[model samples]
Target chain A: MAEKRKIDARGSFCPGPLMELIAGIKAANVGDELEVLSTDRGSAADIPEWIKKVGHELLTTTEENGVWHITVRKTK
Target chain B: MKIVIVGGGMGGTILGNNLARRLHHELRTGKVRITMLSASDRHMYQPGLLYVAVGSMMPDELYRDQAGLLEPGIVFHVDPVENFMLDKRQVKTKSGAVHDYDVLVIATGSRAVMDSIPGLAENAETFYTEESAVRMLKRLRGFQGGRVVITVGVPHKCPMAPLEITFMLHDFFKERGIGDKVQLHYTYPIGRVHSLENVAKWAAPEFDRLGITYETLFNMKEVDGKTKTLTSEEGSSCKFDLLIAIPAHKGMEVVEKNGLGQNGWIPTNRTRLNMEGQENVFVLGDTTNLPISKAGSTAHFEAEALGENIAAMVKVGSPVRDYDGKVFCFIEAGKDRATYAMFNYTTPPDPKAPTRAVHWFKVAYNKLYWASARGLL
Candidate 1:
């Protein structure tokens, strides 16, 4: 809740944003929230599925000003 | 006078065959002799090894005896080379025998630079050599399940190999019912997934369907054996239980030691396979540091032009042909679906512009090229 992390993955293609998100989550502590900014259209759909399948907590996925922002939390 | 060619590779064998066929009258009259030096009696179809590794081609199909492939007038030397005496125009073998030549063709192709990367010697395995590819096939077959990472390292011979292996791994895992458990990661040093932009158009869609994570523009720096993670230049890393790596490739050390270049790759004119500064010494295939793809098809095209040029140089003392740097690579996209692209360097057509028809054209090309190279065409 206290620790918040952010990863900007704009201008990257598919799986690039997801990979950055995963790496960010791995380094973040449990209960820490990580936000990912991506420009790829696939990232908005891919990041949530990855978070759900891997047992991570997806706080929210939103699009603002032509960029998709995905927030995830380390569950375990 | 005798022409001695070292290494029975694409460049060497192709040059030897074309010369022997073209100069049949001279050879019959005993005016000239052609001798090809090779250590092993086997002649391998290097490109076929990729299909062989992925279970699409069998091992026996990729290999043929040296004698069976060479032209009749070309003599074969089944011995490793000791050294080349450039000034004396002769080559010495390990058996204390010296062979002289009027013209020398050092077509010794490259070997995999396996030791260039950290942990490759101890942790990672490669498909660079025929022997190693066979080992990799066995390693791929025995895998029940685990994290799979297919990486294309620096200075690799064929750039499309990692992508092919990635698709093959996807199919391999799906058939074994362990596709879900196996974490697949594809990595490359180029900006796009494929070096050519045209091919990337098709590749981008393929990766999307397979859910295969591809990391581009990341140079593989090192492998941590303790953690099983391969680190890249941009601080990105992937952990893998099974690591099949394509290491850096370098030309034969014999050429490198003679001051060809840093990695044994000689700088050659893109339009002609001839060495930049040296006369009478031409380089082709994976040996030369040409600004083209190191696929067999490119070599086949180069050999055709160089073969004619060599004939012209002998008869008229001038080259009549030049290499166009054209390359067409067939990318296997699993389940018999493939896509290919054709383009040339030094031109402004743009790269990676793949046509949907490239997929079928590539299949026909593979068959056509092999038959032609084997003299069946």
Candidate 2:
């Protein structure tokens, strides 16, 4: 079973959410799911860009009540 | 491992504190040591100088004791590096002490050199330093009002400073009841009002709405102090009543003297943040030849990457992460409104309309910076 990890980076700025996502991805096993909660609007677009560049699988990205939920699956 | 950090500005301080907290166990067990060498004992929140220029923040409020800001596991020294013997993995300080290190991190920040431009030092009002910010405040207070031209130079720190100062000046003069007399004319070296296309798109319309005229591709050439005239390399001139220049910046002189790089920028691997050709020597902040915006936020993000990597290297024999060239900067639009720009190496920024909420956040950040330096944020 692929475990899931959640990183809460709400109220943090741009790179904070990104850094937390990276840290979460590093700790997750390959094929595990990772979700990042970020309040930074910039990171909503950026985290997906990072996932694309790094060859990861982006699962879903949604926003509700000013918080962004960016999910990805570890590939390597 | 002896880790010697040269330069104790925003980048170095944040990196030092981050490592100290992460590698505390190794530090106490005598497996690792972190020492910071700096020019001064005081750390200045340099971004505050813009507010100081506009009389919102005092100079004293911008500084904290450098030693007090450090973590317990780190050793702090007020000795500036005089020579860099990179081959020997050692740095000699001004106090005649040579320290060798297993790892070296150079965070020697850049400086705004007014003298780099002919007649600019004597003729223009600037706010890059403490003395100059106060002087600019005085200059703004006594201005009788005319064509006040704000010219920007390349390689300067804080990408948004030139624009922010221009916006603040508009609000300042307007609050003083001289808004009609003050004609704010802004000039940029690039073809657009800003380098980033979206930021330029947003700012150009804002300038128009504020009745602030601007000229793009107006690269500053020389200022004739006697005639109060400013000339650009593009065969243009401005006869201005007052000239405010965001002067061209270069990394610290020590970096150039040691043959690290030309114009004081060390050749660095953009992702690894290591000085080119050296595995153990790293460079960050304004010292790197990275094409990213040289802002405090750049250093902060770089510090986080370095902290994670260095800690992993110490604990597990390898680094785990790479910097993604992340940078975030708040832009103050006039009348208590602000916007921000956030981007990395791969993605360009998309800025939006300014809002009062963002402006107040920036104001709050002015106080929050110290906690950030302490690695709490």
Candidate 3:
């Protein structure tokens, strides 16, 4: 079973949300899923790019009510 | 049409990207071209330097490749400008390349001259550059306890930086458990602590709460690194264990060498931002000798208007838009909260209460700024 964690980075800006996601990914085990909530519009694109760069798998990303929820799985 | 932009700093890059997007149709049809000449390949997010100094951010995160931040249609040249042959309507590069232009935009921005104040180059730490910010961070980490003095040289960019440093220092030292052992001092050349009256008033309570001493009308005349003292033109002196001074700022040397500047700053039309006496030339950002705060936000606002004006000039030989000198500045009160001020040439900014929300907004802006440079925002 894959464990899951959530990072509430909502109301944080750019690198802020990105930094939080990195930390979240670091603490999670391999194959664990992490979700990040961010109000910054840039996160919708930046988070996916970062996950790809770090060899993480992006599960899904959804935006609703002016917030972005990005989900990723740790690969290594 | 060949539009050549000199200097690839924030203002120059943003304007180039915007212009390239606006002229995309003409570019695809081979009727227009945009070129940007940058001295170096790095584009620095200058506002983040403060965070680097406070140990909240890394220096590497504040810079990016200049070429990568431009739109697809714009050409990027990694060449240092040596001279502006305004008479010939061309620019000469250090590599012996001469580029003619139908339109030229000067966005070389400003540079900090440490030599202006004696001993400052040898003693003090400044946060204007990545190297200096890193050095300041190292110095702060080793700070035991003493008087910390932060002063601003007049007419510098980001007038609120010294204040931000003061507030951040207060929070930093408090967190380190030496808050009482260190005395924080701030000095300004003007009579008021801030250029904007309302901002000064809004900061009063915060300054008082943080126990940061504010000194006004103190123009730094010289510094004695050996003695660890700073002397002002008014015959006042303050001794410090560590000194953080914002060095004197001036326009790029190439501009002064070409007789394009007055007192080392390019003079431009207030509303249109066109260089004085040069019909096809434009100036924006800290390079211009405008009586406004030399902030990135000011440049951002000026770029919005200048881009429209340039497009109109290329099409009809006249500008359809007018700039009102609007500028916004976000002041970081501490680690978690920030405040903002918005104003223009004729009106003072309405005071906004400090909040964590504004701080988050500033954080968001830092990320969005890259997108903006690429013309995606």
Candidate 4:
């Protein structure tokens, strides 16, 4: 079964959001979806790069109200 | 699980406080224990040393009681680690006590080795330590006017110290009304003013505008006090009236003695931040052999990542997250202007023009660093 988790790292900086996503993925089963919310501009750009390199699937990255929402799915 | 942390510098102290907060329930229930072993009872805000040298700040403001910084759940001790027993998962301290841990963290910071070059310790005025900063301040106060040469060494603790001290000194002499009488010359071991390409590009013009001369590719091989000369490996010699040095750094003595890594830097997995081949032993701060700049911000970020992962490991039986070589450094550009560099493993820092607002933020951060060490920031 595919599950979904949201990591609230809205006020955190780069690597903080990415770390939260990693933690979410660690606790999720394969095919689980994780979304990270970060206000850090750096993290919004960096989180996708991390997922791409790690062989995960990046679904979408959007920015609204000075916040970035990044969604990814566990591949392995 | 017994979590034993070695070296109560910024990394260890922050990690201890972070875990204490994260694992408060486990700590209260005796399910997990966090113990911190440090050499000194005091914590020094190292960045203030540069300000101390320039007579802008006092030495007393740089330190705090290390024990007071920790949370109530942590077991803090003033015992320095003398030997590492990694195989047995135990460490012997200077006071002849042995501590065993399921997980160990090494955060023993690096030190400036002035004596590495001949006559360096005797001739050059460096501001790396509290004593050295005070001595450098005295040297600058007594100095009337002459050719002042600043030489930098590789692998130092603070990445921006060389440039920061130069700009601060330029202002220092101007305030003393000796700006015209003194000629400030800066030298770097590398072919640029700074190791970072963008920073060098930005700083080179600023150095010119300030009328401070600089020489790149000036690697200091030896310093002769009698001749008042500094010789570089590339066959360059410079005469100096007063010499200021940014000495090379090496890992702590205990690290070198334990054969952890070459020159006291432990071989660490860049992402996992663990000692190579030892999953239970983690290395942070200046102790890790990571190629990133060994700045306090580096340690702080690493401590945050490690704190999260360690706490998760205890709770979930698996560690989560990796440190992505993130380091943020504030560069003081003198004249009440400052800038910052933020970068990580995949990206390089693009520092824009200097700003007074950023400088004030840096000033504010100097005071707020205590909260940072307590894992509150």
- Using Cα atoms, each model's DockQ against the true complex is 0.02, 0.02, 0.01, 0.02
Model 3 has a DockQ score of 0.01
Q: Return the DockQ of model 4.
A: 0.02
Per-residue lDDT tens digits for candidate 4, residues A1-76, read 9988766665333224654465356447889898887766766665676575557899988999988888899988
For residues B195-282, write the lDDT of model 4, one tens digit per residue: 6667888999999999999987566779999999999755788999999999888889899899897578788887889999999999
Per-residue CA lDDT of model 1 for B1-377, tens digit only, reads: 67787888766777778877777887889887889888778877777777666666677876678877888888898886768776687789878789987777767777777676788767776776677778878887788788888776655677678777788779877887888878787786655676555556667787888898878755567888899989875567888898888776667787767776646767776676767776766777777656456667667667777878877766777889767766656676763666655555433123343344665665566556545555444
TM-score of chain A of each: 0.91, 0.93, 0.92, 0.91
CA lDDT of each candidate?
0.71, 0.87, 0.81, 0.86
TM-score of each: 0.77, 0.83, 0.82, 0.83
TM-score for candidate 1 (chain B): 0.90
lDDT tens per residue, model 2, B1-377: 99999998999999999999999999999999999999999999999999999899999999999999999978888999999998888999999999999999999999998886799999999999999999999999999899999998766789899889999999999999999999999997655687666888899988999999999757687999999999975578998999999988888999999999867878888789999899999998989866667899999999999988988989998989989889999999985999999988657688888999999999999999999999999
Q: Clashes in model 2: which pairs?
A: none
**Residue B202 lDDT in candidate 1:** 66
Model 3 chain B poorest 10 in a row by lDDT: B188-197
Point out where model 4 deviates above 4 Å: A1-76
Ranking by TM-score: 2, 4, 3, 1
